[model samples]
Target: MAGRGLHHVTLISSDAERSCRFYACFLGMRLVKRTVSHEDPGTFHLCFGDEAGRPGTLFTLFPWQRVPRGRRGACEAWQTSFRIPSGSLDWWSRRLSEADVPHRLDQTAFGENCLTFEDPDGAMLALVEANPFTQPAVWNSSEVPAAHALQGLHDLVLKVREADPLSELFREVLGFTEIGRNGKLVRLATHDGAGGTITLDETGRLARGQLGAGSIHHVAIRARDAADQDALVQALHDRYGIVTTEPKDRIYYRSVNFRSTCGLLLEIATDGPGVDVDESFEALGMGLKLPSSLEERRGELELLLPSLPIPTCNRHVFEEIT
Candidate 1:
């Protein structure tokens, strides 16, 4: 089955408040939802994205408060990239400087210009020039103007020791076509620049990365519906001998996760019942939201979890990026 595009990317953070400031205040993503993780309800699961929290726009995090810092190396998603409008790099550079967030501007071997920076917890991220075919929804409440705001994710970068076996999975199982390659970086595109693209970087000498604070949790691929997700899951098991989790309801969407040959976690997620499924668009990310199962203990959870500043109308709390 052919995959649609990227659904979302989930990463680990040590400080939810700091992360929220970096993303919502500096980077200008909407704090779409705030809820507890299904697996570990004690910790928070925060969602950030474009205006409406579209599939490819989603950048989520699990705040593992006391976890140790992770090292970046092979067998990990090293960077998550967002698409920005053409010619907006200079504006972004100035903005980053104003916020005192250091970043470097560089061009890929494939000719895409990107600005790379780290979040509060050192999760690597970038903003690349958007492909003409990919138009991400503009965030109206963004600190930056709509024209200069970050678009949806352009692609993701995975570092591994070998690319052949992973290439097979991208081509055969994930419905991504090998578009181009430059030395150690191989580009795989789902719809030829329509959105979801992955670059596999072969780094034979580096050690494998550990999962902890500031590390990526999993890279989720987009599926149109349940049938499409099921087909891909079946293909993974039958063809690659990969064992994946049965579809688990994530409230926003249903997801199934598995690890790659190199040990990078991969998830296949449906595109709907989005972040606004429970909360309305107008009141998104306003307060702590709990699923029905956790509603009974909402009072207890509220007392335990630290309160985060609301980015919508309360921008003063995050006035300084330092």
Candidate 2:
């Protein structure tokens, strides 16, 4: 069976508020959920995405204040990219400049215009004008206008020591089609458009990556339902002798995680019981949310975790544009 598409990308952040300002205020994404990490209760887990916090649009972050900076090398996701409307690069370029975010414009081998930049914590990011202009979900409170708002994740760039094994796994197991290659970069994507693309770079000589702040933890692929996820888990074990962890309840979605042959962590997530399950659509991200398991400890946990400031967009900055 073919994969649905990407679900979300999770990253580690050094400061919660700084990351929020960059993603919510500068990039025009909405902070859809505020909660604590299930694995580490002390760290904050912030979920950002389109207005509804859809699976393909989700970008989740775990803020660990004291973590060291991460170095990008082999066996790591090097860059995370978002989809932008065609012909909006110039507007984005000026906006990034006004926000004091350093960025450079470049084109991929496939001829898509890209604006590459780094987050405050040094995580590599990009905006690619891949698809035609389509109106994305508009957050009424966003500093950016609806016409130029970000669509969703465009693609991810992974650097690894060996590409052939992972490449085979993506095609044979994940149902990705090899679309194109430019030298060492090989592009693959599912037939589904949103968050479906991936670029693999074979860099055998680079050192293994160190996980810390400003590093991507894992990228999740979408499973249409529970049965779809089971098939993917079974295929991994039966065909390649790869073992995956049993599905873990993530509150929003159930996930099964495994390491690819190239040592990159990947997850298959069921696309139900979404972010709005715990909170109403209109009140999302306004209050701290805890899973049932943590509900009893909510009072204590809130006092232990550092409070994050609510992000507000600078209206004057956006008003200056156009």
Candidate 3:
């Protein structure tokens, strides 16, 4: 079935608090959740996004204290794109410059102009004009100075050794059609355009990507609910022999993940039990809104976590708490 759009994109991090500070201050996102990793404790999982903490806007961090740094040449994620106002390219450039942020300026085959940069932890990311090709975003009630904040994740590029199996899944299974194909890259996309496009690349049998500050954990696609997710999971198994787990509640939403043949990771997530379900959108990240069990440990958690609000340039000093 033609389904819901892009959900959140998850990634791994070496330092959760430090990464959180970078994203929150620099990107103007709200810290929606901070908890121990479901798979491992001592390790932490954090999420950042607009006040509402909607799907497309959600970005998660998995702080694996032992992961090593990775190189950027190939075999890893190419870049993550963000949406900005139509004429905000100049403003963004100035903001990045003022922040002393290191980035690159170039034009994509789609003809959109872009500026790439690395986060404090070396995660590759970029800012692109949400111009003549994109629609205006609905601002979040809890997002500060809302209008200028990012609408959501624009798109992401995955540089794999091969694109055949992965590209086939995007179209034949997920319903994303190949909208643009060019040298080394094939782009599959959804309508919202916020989760913009998924670009699959054939950059040779590149080295396997390392999970560090800048590496993606998995890209999550939106699934309606338990019933819907079950059906979709079955579809993947039936059609492609790709198996997925039963939906597991992630506190905020339910999800299941599977690795693609090309080595990319993908997850299907439900939209409900939204950010507001746990905390009001307008009041998110304002306090240490922790689970009752974690409440008693807040003092220790806070102390263990690094300081929030890392430095950044003019526009917004986005910070992230990994």
Question: Against the true structure, what is each candidate's TM-score?
Answer: 0.93, 0.94, 0.85
Model 1, total clashes: 0
Candidate 1 lDDT by residue in tens digits, 1-322: 7877778888998877877877887778888999998878889999988888888888899988767889887888988888888999999999878767779999876899989988767888889987555455667654778888877778888899999899999899888889899999999988744347889999988987788888998889988878889999999989979999989988888899999877888899998888889888888888888888999999998888766777542443224333
Q: How should the candidates be ordered by lDDT, best one leading?
A: 2, 1, 3
lDDT winner between candidates 2 and 3: 2
lDDT of 1 at 191: 73
Worst 10 residues of 3 by lDDT: 310-319
- Model 3, range 1-322, lDDT digits (tens) per residue? 7656578887776665556656776666767766655554445667777556777778888777546765554444667888766666677677688777777787776777778887766777877776533443444433234555677778788887788777787777677888888887888886655674677778885677556656777788887787777877888898888878767777778989886666567888988878676667666655544555566777787776545443233332333333
Stretches of candidate 1 above 4 Å error? 192-195, 312-322
Off by over 4 Å in 2: 133-135, 138-140, 314-322
Residue 43 in candidate 3, Cα distance off native in Å? 3.0
- lDDT by residue (1-322, candidate 2, tens digit) is 8977689999998877777877888888999999988889888889999899987788999988767888787988989999887888999999888877778999976788999998877899999986642446745455777767888888888998878788899888888889999888899998535688889998979998888888998989999888889999999998888899988998889999999887789999989889999899999998999888989998899888876778766443222112
Cα lDDT of candidate 2 equals 0.84
Residue 76 alpha-carbon offset, candidate 1, angstroms: 0.8
Which 10 consecutive residues of model 1 have the lowest summed lDDT? 313-322
- Candidate that would win on lDDT: 2
The residue pairs that clash in candidate 1, if any, are: none
Q: Which wins on lDDT, candidate 1 or candidate 2? A: 2
Best by TM-score: 2
